[model samples]
Target: MADSRSGRSDSDALIRVETLAKRYETAAGTTPPALNGVDLAIQPGEFVAVMGPSGSGKSTFMNILGCLDTPTSGAYYLDGRNVAELSDDELATLRNRLIGFVFQGFNLLKRISVADNVALPLVYAGEGKSERRRRALELLDQVGLAAHADKQPNQLSGGQQQRVAIARALSNHPRLILADEPTGNLDTHTSEEIMDIFTRLNRDQGITVVLVTHEADIAHHAKRLVRFRDGNVVYDGGVKGI
Candidate 1:
């Protein structure tokens, strides 16, 4: 874990990574570095996109940022906290408290109502049923799905299911939203609507968003773009450079 006192220059950055590296031991006496000397800083309320070819380490980077995995070396300060040293259970708790994830697939339970699907994370946090229901309803309304609360996930269209997924991701009021190919399964129009929701969350609620995609058009929706190639960040700059 990277301590706050370790090479942290920007006092206001929500995410700070310096000399971050990850490696895995394979065959005898050989180690492969998934991320080699990666340095990045993401500010509060910023929308950043990570673009890369297959096996370029974008997925590994997202895992580290979301606290799902730890780096082999270097420092990562998330919201001013050094999460690299946290225990597995502590990391899980921190993830639940600070990060919301949106994957390409909605990943909702088939038999549950849209409201119940959105409330699953809250339920994991040990909230009471009534409180969870109230918050779920609030999020559904926020995502324009209050009318579909009673419908099961199977009953919804792809776009509508994604909206429910977005609402569910906001259930805990997370500080960071980690989206991996969030619009991969949607058409252009639906993808735009999803990006609009992400933009609103970042601009209106100050939530930091980190999105991973291979498509240049999808990456353009973000203000900053980080490009990865061959397991390294070849470029990290504004979307204009994409």
Candidate 2:
């Protein structure tokens, strides 16, 4: 873990990273940094698109931002808390409390009902089964999947499964939703549907969203775009999209 001066800067930004860097150690000692001197600030209610070629460090950036891994050097202040300084256990708790994640693969439990899958996080939080079931059904309704609450994951189409994943992500009522290639596996129409859901969540719920994608059209759905190249951010600006 990084130094905990409890050293922190006063920032109201939902996410603030200063000079972030991550380097991996390999058989040959160490590889080039996965992320190099990255500085970024994302405000609450913002939808950000991260784009880059393979190995451009976008994935690394996402991992760091999601608190799955720490930076080699730099400061990451998420909602005013310095993440780099948190212990592993503290990081897990913070992640469960404040970040919801959705990935390219739906990652739903195949054996469980859609409702149960959506309520899984609540189970970890020790909520009563009845309360979890109630919340899960409510979230399913929000995603227009209440009718499929008892359906098995394999019985649902790709789009619906992704929607379930989104519902599960929202299960914890996290402050930020981090999605990686969420539309990568879907058809164009399905992709749009997924993006529409994200748009609505950001617009109606004011949840900060950061998504990484390889598609330019998909990235355009976001209000802001940040492009990375060779471990450096080559572009950061507003987009014309809503």
Candidate 3:
């Protein structure tokens, strides 16, 4: 199926998947594929939510889209690069450069200060210490945690911690942000706060934001929803209010 914004130039698309599929081999036998011939496209600056039941292939799809796992068959082109053909090191480099990831768990380093944690990706990118610290502080300010830059993640509330995670995800200035259940650990109030951060980033920076969640309330915040079932897309359309 076509995306809601038809006639989008292919070069402008941020993500493109063609007949993507993944299978797991077990001792019992080759089980049903986790993803079966899926096709999807996402445009830059679009906020899209993916929803599905457990084992519905949504997680697998996210993993593949994030380049943490490769598809067994079919193709995935991210930002015009063919991911299926990239070497392991190339894939890692591409992932680090093009995408930022946020998880349900805040995934913070317990011993590190908030600013240091936000600077971790830049460390891998070989940014100088001064540059890293400056960037980290900037991101902390962006997430409304500039005062907490000196504190550890454990000192913050769940909402504050997730905000830190969002800041860390944006540290590299990635074009796309992939968030998996980023609101799962938060209360309704905190969840709304986190979603607001996501929507703000999407709206202000033109960063493509795609999240996977089971909560309808959470998915509704996105402009479009793509529902998956039995390893295939069941729905792809704009939200009710457009």
Candidate 4:
């Protein structure tokens, strides 16, 4: 996709942030900025893992990237459009069109069927019921969970529920996937299974994946790793050797 404002092609960075920072206000006082002057760029189809301990600011950065939170300073460019300049509705539309999010929790509704859960995003995007069902089943099939389409969330294992979440994230055919500790709730083998699906999506389908995980083993699955410390990015490089 080309950016009308900058006239940049798809070869340009899909996500770019310059000196990005965010701070939250507490009842006592203003807390320290969660992110402080971080600069980074992610190209299309790149799989990057973000790692940091509690209070390290990785989650804050991911929230900003996902358009779930606003930065207090600096600029974030998604597909060459400045996030700081977009209105709330524009941000919502951009998020729905260009980004998919997967969280550690399955976040499935117990009242809904697995296929309906996968189709949730489509519902928000104003898709017809039949079309939503079609897309949901196709995505479920991709994640190896088509057989469970008629089941409820409680009927599936943690891993299966997470697969349903992944299918939901793909419903809009988003260019970027922001996954926050996607395997945190799963066991070792189940974590591996989820990572395998992510790897296949990034490699075969050319989807850009930015995942935040505290586990070193989970970070290794990504081609590149970004480590945060004390509200700053201390490391950004290949996954090997920490």
Best by TM-score: 3
TM, every model: 0.91, 0.92, 0.96, 0.94
Instruction: Identify the runs in model 2 with alpha carbons over 4 angstroms from their true place.
Output: 1-10
Which order, best to worst by lDDT? 3, 4, 2, 1
Q: Which residue pairs collide, candidate 2?
A: none
Cα lDDT listed for each candidate:
0.87, 0.89, 0.91, 0.90
TM-score of candidate 1 relative to the true fold: 0.91
What would the per-residue lDDT of candidate 2 be over residues 184-234, giving only the tens digit for each residue? 999999999999999999999999999999998898888888889989999
**Model 4 pairs in collision:** none
lDDT by residue for model 4 over 137-242, one digit each (tens)? 9999999998999999999999999999999889899999999999999999999999999999999999999999999999999988889998898888888877
Clashing residue pairs, backbone N/CA/C < 3 A, model 3: none
Over all chains combined, what TM-score does candidate 4 have? 0.94
Query: Candidate 2: worst 10 consecutive residues by lDDT?
Result: 1-10
Instruction: Kindly list the per-residue Cα lDDT of model 1 for residues 1-242, writing each as its tens digit.
Output: 22322454576788888888888777775466789989888877779999988888899999999887888899999888787767888788777778999989988899889999999999889999999999999999998989999998999989899999989989999989999899999998999999999999989998999999988888888888888886688887778745
**True-structure lDDT of candidate 3:** 0.91
How many clashing pairs per prediction, in order? 0, 0, 0, 0
Which 10 consecutive positions of candidate 4 have the poorest summed lDDT? Answer: 1-10
Point to the candidate with the largest lDDT: 3
